[model samples]
Target: MEATPQAPSPLEETQRSGLALGLVVWVFSLLGVLGALYARWAWTPHSVTVEGASIQHLFDVILAIILVAFVLVHLLLGYFIVRYRARGSESALYFPHHTALEVTYTAVPAVVMVALSVAGILLWSRVHAAPPPDAFVVEVRGEQFGWSARYPGPDGKLGRVDNRIQRPFNVDPEDPAGRDDVTSPEIYLVVNRPNRILLRTRDVQHSFWVPAFRLKKDLLPGATTELVLTPTQRGEFDLACAELCGVGHYTMAGKVRVVTQQEFDRWLRQQGRR
Candidate 1:
């Protein structure tokens, strides 16, 4: 004979009411969190570089993955809470393991992680790749309190400055090639032209950073580091040190001036053959 349906006890009805209320509150809370996150995303300062744009795209992909996981987990948690709520008539069901479910969860994450790593490696290689042969070269020196820039003289060659020759002015008086080098208080570049910067530090370690160009590199005392980029837009931007070198680290700053090719040539001439 089939079992007859029985009415729920008054206490059981109260428990169900409470469970429903809790579920509504929890779901609304998740929605509120989602809304807040969206608002934060809408209002944020951003970097303006071709590579930086690509990096942001990568960030979005990772964020999407995280969000999907978040929503799925929350839904499951809510489902379990409602489905197995305290009911006197029902008993628990136990299954040790589900092979397909386990395999799916493991395999999906492994695939996603591998894909992300591969994409990151490709982007890294592209950004760090060699600049073209016709690229113009510039030199930058990071010091305790400020930065010094050097442009190739009329010879279109940067005079070599040895790291061993440390002095008051941060330049070697002995190198003839470097004698013609012009040190500028700021970095000036022609828009849309490839500029490769040679980086060095005078006393300690420092990092050369320009946000708009999405370029940064460490300046070590005894070695030279290189960063290459081409400015697409004409604007003035701040160049900052990303490292904590010492007491005057906050003052270690510079500027990037992206101008027309003609203007850049004229400015170089104005600096003259130093």
Candidate 2:
């Protein structure tokens, strides 16, 4: 039997409502993108250090360029969709691929990648270069859920520490270095000085992250990892565990306090006397 055409009812109203809602969503999405671009461009720089300023400025430029390109691409795409929508009597045009257009697009991106890579490498080298002779050395140990730090005394030579022989709240009876090493829950450092952090994990992987300083390094079991950071600004920064540990992943939070050399010394002396 031939099918009969159905008359429109409340169901047709529902369809229209859905279409209107979809349009609203699309428009809001475009506005959301614009808002994000504005926020990124107008963000204030909080860290006054050179390294921090460089990172913020670099990201701002990169994000602005990306947002502009994104906006242009979408604008052209929307225009094409409306301009070339199917009509009752018209057929679609067919064209062969343009080699010139492909080459131009590929070359531009290649040139951009090369420039970005060079700049990244230079920044990395600046952060990871070997510390000077007077640089402060600190050893960091990661256990299941906490960080323990050890600072070499005034001698500047890190007394050796073997975790196997070391006990909680007490130094190992065997390792001689544990006698002079300063261990604490708080990882302290002297600002405006070259500081090297030696990282190690006892059980699983952990990451030493200080967002303010823009520094992060993984802490692995057995082997020791190291990263150099010189904090030129003095303030309190949040340190988070970058790697996913277990159910306690969300609770792994650490504090980073950047202070002057004099304050650091006072804190160190107080800890030593304890």
Candidate 3:
């Protein structure tokens, strides 16, 4: 008769399980890192506004922190899983807790969060503080399935708009300031000049998003919102409605054209004639 076969030791089984789990964790973590890197390199849009650079910088800082923490935490977790696997007949160590470790973990995250909050607040203030005295102003109105832009004519003032009024562009027929208002299907901005965009909605909620400018503002029904940015480059960019309003949400799109001051003025004149 053949000699009786012996079963594998508990320690060997534990080692195999620990090694498998650790390998899985490490592999997934690596893949996640690679995917993030690829997306950042291939998908991030170019910054075309002064504020876009700052926004991108803040994003990079935040992403770096998150990726670092993610890698470190996973690395340590995998290491612990394999290093502390159960050994047969060995009692488990039960050193309840370490005060230093707990405090370090809590305090580090708290400090990091506070710092990030402060940075965000400062950036917000700068973005929405105030437009320059001579900043170019345009009004963007959102309706279901489309967007419209209104430029103040030579009057340099946007006429009063009332949602209650049933009229083209909702312009108050009584407000003389609106008479010269030129409405367009596209937005026109002057490169290298501060632009103040007034956002409004006709029926439901909508969001005005210009990816290249790194700005997104909501067009809330019955209310007005504002966004200010200075285009540093002159080019045509795509504008999108970043909200779901109705069945035709996907079709609500527009174009943003940044041109020289002279070109913008000439275009305004041409639009006013129409």
Candidate 4:
């Protein structure tokens, strides 16, 4: 009797395979969730602007929703795969219709999408709204391999700029408003003060990005764009072009210095003198 042992049935083998695959999927899904959690907690950059915290919060909310959906989807998929695996002499079940299920899935996602869209629109409106009357103004010009900043001097008015003028800051030399404009290689912002930046490009398209500020705006050739922000921290941060313009794209880098109002004023005065 002991020597008459037989092979396992096909049904038993199929169940075992399904169970193993399901377990693998679950394990991988958990690992992915952990990795994302770790990245969110440890790798996220600090927000240094007044509006950056709100932006980060919105991003975190989106990520959390996505992760929740991801986990639920994978878990359900694994369960379905294991529960519905083919067995000997067994046929798959077919449903003629599932109205409630269909409506639930469709409505839930549609509602969520609409909610997120509204939130994004509100945030965008607030961020791009007209700058305060006393907001500091600066012009950021992008060129082939570098960045330059122009500040309105004592008159507090950025002069007319003609792309064809081809001068520093493109200031129309004849425009009286541009007579005291100050140009610099780096952008200087005043802490706790609203700053309005006018964006322009000399050639190809470029993007002005400051990670700490959580702000990025595209600079299109022959057109002007604007970005407004209020810095809450006083420090130097890296500014880089996010768009790839040409071979020298990687070399398009600059500095963003945030300082106290007094310091910013002194720096502007010194630059104007030079």
Q: Give the TM-score of each candidate.
A: 0.79, 0.79, 0.92, 0.91
Select the stronger candidate by lDDT from 3 and 4.
3
Could you tell me the lDDT of residue 158 within candidate 4? 89
Candidates' C-alpha lDDT: 0.78, 0.73, 0.91, 0.90
Query: TM-score of the candidate numbered 1?
Result: 0.79
Candidate 4 per-residue lDDT over residues 1-274, each given as its tens digit: 4786778788788889998999899999999999999988787679999888789888899999999999999999899988888677778889999999999999999999999999999998988899998998999999998898898989999899988997876789888989988888878888898999899999999999998888899999999999999999899998999999999999999999999989988888888666
Worst 10 residues of 3 by lDDT: 84-93
The residue-by-residue lDDT of candidate 2 on 21-124, one tens digit each, is 55555576599687886676465436534566667666766776677767677666555555554444567988889899999989987887787778778877
Q: Tens digit of lDDT per residue, candidate 3, span 82-179?
A: 87877677777789899999999999999999999999999989988889989999998899989888999899988998889998878998999999
All candidates: CA RMSD (Å): 6.3, 5.3, 2.0, 2.4
Ranking by lDDT: 3, 4, 1, 2
Clashes of 1: 2
Candidate 1 per-residue lDDT over residues 116-206, each given as its tens digit: 9999999889778898887878888888889888887777877666656665335677767666778877787767777788888778999
Cα-lDDT of candidate 1: 0.78
Residue 246 C-alpha lDDT in model 4? 95
Higher-lDDT candidate among 1 and 2? Answer: 1
Highest-TM-score candidate: 3
Model 4, clash count? 0
